[model samples]
Target: MIDFYKYQGTGNDFILIDNSKDDFKANKVDYAIKWCDRKFGIGADGLIFIEPSTKGDFLMDFYNPDGSQSFCGNGSRCSVAFAKFLGIIKDQTNFEAIDGMHQAVISDKHVKIEMQQYGAIESIGNDHFIDTGSPHYVAYRNGVNENIVEYGKSIRYSDRFKTKGTNVNLIAEKGDRNIEIWTYERGVEAETLACGTGATACGISFAQKHNIDKGIIEVKAQGGHLRIHLEASKNDKVYQNIWLEGPAEFVFKGVIEDEN
Candidate 1:
């Protein structure tokens, strides 16, 4: 039997298990789809199993709701919280994600995640393409939820990203330093409340498009609010510290002897 905890960051929720001994084998996609079922199972956007790492503090082996992906950003934030809950690390922690090893710091209520530095943002037809550990299509709009899903799905399922459908993010600039965002995750096939990497990508992409320097930008999502702090860089080397601060309350803990 395995004891697991549920955590959510701005509505992009997940099921987490502390597999510190690497004794768990969840290599099947059907398992994730079944476990992530909202009505029939634990109900989450994805699932994560933490294992002991020889290269870092921990290793986050994650999966999407569709039982496909592993490098989920919001899931990673929840995993950080879970790791803290298990006393695996302290205020600061480092873990290897599917993309790579990520560093983060846990405050009283907020968590500041230091993401990896990828390449410069790319411009698509009417949007910019950036990979915040996961591919994202960012389009600034006056308001989201207006056919954004319909508009984003074409791109998400298109040959460009069909193999691993990309996450769609719609961002609306509020003020000089605030923004409202809505996201459509690939695996979940809907608009989730918050997307940690999506929010992070939009924050920096917005900064680049607007030419804003270092500042804290609020990303208001359907689930809750998240804060992003970006460091303006020259020569397209922008670095950032994103905080997916929101509810990570425990929902329920139990054991599943038979994962059927």
Candidate 2:
């Protein structure tokens, strides 16, 4: 049996496990696939393991529903909240993830996380590609309809990204500093409620296109709202000091009765 806590940030849900003691030994990928199943298991977009860290407060081990390892923005925020629940940190904490070190602050009802600096961006046709902690493809459109899943899938599994796959974000500008995004995550392979890294990547992509490098942008996802703060990097196309702020709520806690 495994004790787990479920949490969600902007509707991006995760199954969090405290493996700091190194006693919970289970095949990670297998468990991720099983527990992330909505009908068969715990039902989450991903799984996060809180383990001991040498470089920071703790180590965030994140896995997708398909059992692939990836850096998740909302999952990272949920990890921060989980750390607080475990009495590991107070108001603020720093943790190491697959992407590297990240800092987060716990607020009244939200958690703000600092994303890594990205310096590489390529414009492929009308779309933009950027790795905001996670590889993402940002495409602009007028309205986000139901066909986004099919459109995003075509691009996500296209020859350009077929081998590795990439998250696809369909974005539409609402107004100055406001944008709406719908993401088809790679591992999830479906349209999720929201994606932190996808929103962050969208903010940077929009900034580069319009020449607005530094500022806060409001990103509306299907789940809820998120705020992304970006600072101009030394390079013309790079962005730094990117912060993702949103609400992460505790859903429930339980022990898995069956492990078979």
Candidate 3:
């Protein structure tokens, strides 16, 4: 039997397991593929493992539904909340991920995470590309009536990103400080409720295109809403101090008796 927790951040759900004692010995990739199956298993966008961290409060190991390593934005926030539940962290904590170290603050209702810095965004044709922990292709999309899956997949598997692949996001500016985004995550290979990194990328990219240096943008996704704050260097093209803020909730807790 195994114990697990279900957590979600703005509808980006994950199956979390405490492996501090190395209790899980099964093949992680195979297990993720099985348990993340929507119909057959726990059914989540991804899986997260919490292990003791010598570098910080804990280590967040994130895997995509396809069993690939990833640094998920929403999943990372959920990990911070999970660490608090396990009594390993307080309101504010730092954790190491596949990408690097990250800091987060847990309030009474929301989790705000400091994301890594990003370099200049590359503009190709009508699209833009940036790596916000994960690679994302951003395009300004107008209106809501379109085939998201087909359009996103075409860009996701394009020859330019055939090597590592990239997440696809279609965004439309709604107001001066608000935008609506739809993301087709690379790992999930489909449109999800929301994507943290994708939202962050879109916000920053939009700011750059508009020549805005620093500000906050409200991103509305299918799952929920997220706030992305960005600061850019006037002399340099790099963007820094990016923050992603949203809600993280505990859905349920359970144990799996079938060790299959």
Question: Candidate 2's C-alpha lDDT?
Answer: 0.91
Which tens-of-lDDT digit does each residue in 1-260 have in candidate 2?
77899999999999999998877677999989999999988899999999999999999999999999989999999999999999988989989999899999999769999997465888889989899878999999967664778988999889888999999999999999899999999999998999999999998888888889689989999899999998887787888888999999999999987563
Best by lDDT: 2
Order the candidates by lDDT, highest first — what do you get? 2, 3, 1
Could you give candidate 3's per-residue lDDT for residues 117-180 as a string of tens digits? 5567888887889889899899897786667788888988889887798999998889887999
Task: Give the alpha carbon lDDT tens digit for every residue of 83-162 in model 1.
Answer: 88888989898788888878888877566777654777888876888888888888878855477678778779888888
Model 2 CA deviation exceeding 4 Å by range: none
- What C-alpha lDDT, on a 0 to 100 scale, does residue 41 get in candidate 2? 84
**Model 1 TM-score on a 0 to 1 scale:** 0.92
Which pairs clash in the backbone of model 3? none
Determine which window of 10 residues in candidate 3 has minimal summed lDDT: 230-239
lDDT per model vs. reference:
0.78, 0.91, 0.89
Number of the top candidate by TM-score?
2
**TM-score winner between candidates 2 and 3:** 2
Return the candidate ranking by TM-score, descending.
2, 3, 1
